[model samples]
Target: MHKNAFAIHGDIVWSKNPKELQTVEGGYLIVVDGISKGVYPQIPAEYQGITVVDRTGMLVIPGMSDIHVHAPQYGFRGLGMDLELLDWLNTHTFPEESKYANPEYAWRAYQIFSDDLLHSATTRAVVFGTMHVDATMTLMGKLETTGLKTMVGKVNMDRNSPDYLCEKDAATALEDTKKWLDEVEDSHFENTKPILTPRFTPTCSDELMEGLGKLRAERDLPLQSHLSENLSEIDWVKGLCPWSTCYGQTYEHFGQLAGDQPVIMAHCNWCPDNEVEILKENNVFVAHCPQSNAQLSSGIAPIRHYMDLGMNVGIGTDVAGGATLSMFRAMADAVAVSKLRWRLVDQNLAALSTEEAFYLATVGGGKVFGKVGSFDEGYEVDALVLDDSQIKTPLELTLAERLERYVYLAEEGGRIVEKYVAGRRVL
Candidate 1:
């Protein structure tokens, strides 16, 4: 009766080794319904009764993940590209975030982010919502419908932000986050879940961080926030916590780092040696937003070095700060920025190749949810079906090469024809 079995016939790429890419050609990935059983060169005789979905001639890879992103900033992407990190956040981002006070206004904004997510090659993500509880709830409800596996947060920021955007006190901020959790506790999305979001150390008080930390232990949920993304931000973090050794250490001291929490911190552009050790030691996932860093004039992150050091790193759109939703663009930008960084400052062959960059955008980030990011055996089948029909009619290329072209050559909307999250059709 084959209760749970399907045959996925395609060129399957997945990881048996975490670092080295494994590609199986002319293969049929025999999935036990949702979970992959094994990939064979041909459909085996015993599993012939299973439903066979022919993805032959299509490049089947794991659905990409955006581990760090700000959903509220979708409306303002590419607007303030000329500004640096702090200025961009203050002049454009903070004001846009404050607009979410109206849940109606929030839905109008979040719909754009949601629609874009399904449209792109990414199928799983960790998203950030603004502090407005009702608005954040509306955003969550909307994102849940997309069928993407996501962790969303109601952001907490008590001080150093504008009066319109900032909270009056830590207690109120903590209460608001709890209220958010309570409301969404019964929300029915297979993938959408809530996590604690303190905007950053500069805006969060000691009390707020501690309370959230306590809640983290209680719920055993994943955590997401900004880390040493910029020089000014790192210095601001230092000013906030004089006792701490580095930016990441402050979070560690607050018990936010190095646990089973599945913590995701965006941007490691300026992570010092001590900070790197802390992040690596505690098993922190770095949401490497290369384009946002360059657009905001934040220094290029040492991505190759981080990979060499065996740090858990992945790509993020970061939306308005990043100036794009397309992780494909992020992939290209990561490569471009690394080259610039290597030429201008650090010298060496430290640039990220297209292969490496796309790998991070997909598999590296997917590990946060589980064994996602690839289409081998016994893995969740989150996938983005790319259509290069209009873009590449004449070019004869390899599957991986076509994938690279899909990232650089095609515009945002056309390439990702359909999206699948955990073997369920989303597009």
Candidate 2:
């Protein structure tokens, strides 16, 4: 056992429930052996021997998880922002994604991705890598050193993609994925793992989808893909898999959807009844990329409805599509989109609140991967210590209110003073 026990003393803030928030003004977290043991108002006499770090007035919150992001496209964020989904994919996305064939390009691109993510207050992420296996492998290596809990995906696309970007065939794609997995088997990614990433229905043939699904079951790895993101994309899915019920069913028909394996589908901005039921039935997690949806002109997702149905969901930065890696901004955008969605879609489901958004960014989707996401007792000690020493907020503001305000408007400099993963400070 390690003798280096640790504790964080600060003004702690975190969720108490899905709908409620909590704060302890003079709270401290006891991180025993890299896992949280308990939170307290003062150090207990029995545990006085452990080392403690004092933050005085800084806010300590659970580290965030980004459920969907593209590692290769991190550099292209905010460019080509005016185009909608299909046009955007052909113009900016495919062109940029094709450059990964050169391992040198991968290093340059992924270095920006890894470094930005390292400092962005996101301690856990589900990331998409470009289709080139070698380039994707390079990304996995860089991510391992960042100390974030990540699922790095090697993207698959066999049809209707650019000549330079698409895979040669199903067999080659699967083999490439296998090779990447094999190489990483000994790399000790720590908390990072490889996932199956099919680039949506139109890009994958039936054969490739089925092969990946089987591999998922055999290895128990998670699946990440786009779902109902845009009108044209959904139409393309219907045309390709006409026998299926809806966009989600295309994956379901080929044994690709879910059984015991984990599936995270991004941008469910337009899922229908059967699709939502399929998600609920199989326990699939929805990765809500609000800024991406807004930027790509994909309609607002019915997030309030999903929460009403008790579906698990989380916020994602979505990088080039969404624009920023700051989970703080993503949380604010999530609430903004949900309020817009509530006005247009359905008013019955509660509009998104700050508590719900922050909770989703932390513990909600982290539950999909296990033992990650929160400072809850027995949870991993992945957390962020904010340096708000210079902020001039009115002293009357509650810590939770101050946190909510920070999420809406704080720049990267003020909020993330130091980042921690499993009780060890990384930055």
The model with the greatest TM-score is: 2
- What Cα-based lDDT does every candidate model obtain? 0.82, 0.86
For candidate 1, the TM-score is 0.95
lDDT of 2 by residue, 263-306 (tens): 89999999999999999988889999999999999999888788
User: Lowest lDDT 10-mer window, candidate 2?
Assistant: 387-396
Candidate 2 total steric clashes = 0
lDDT of 1: 0.82
After superposition, the stretches of candidate 2 with alpha carbons farther than 4 Å from their true spots are none
Predicted candidate 1 versus true structure: per-residue lDDT over 91-197, tens digit per residue: 99999999999877887888888888877777988999999999888878888888888999999899899999999898998888888888988675567998788
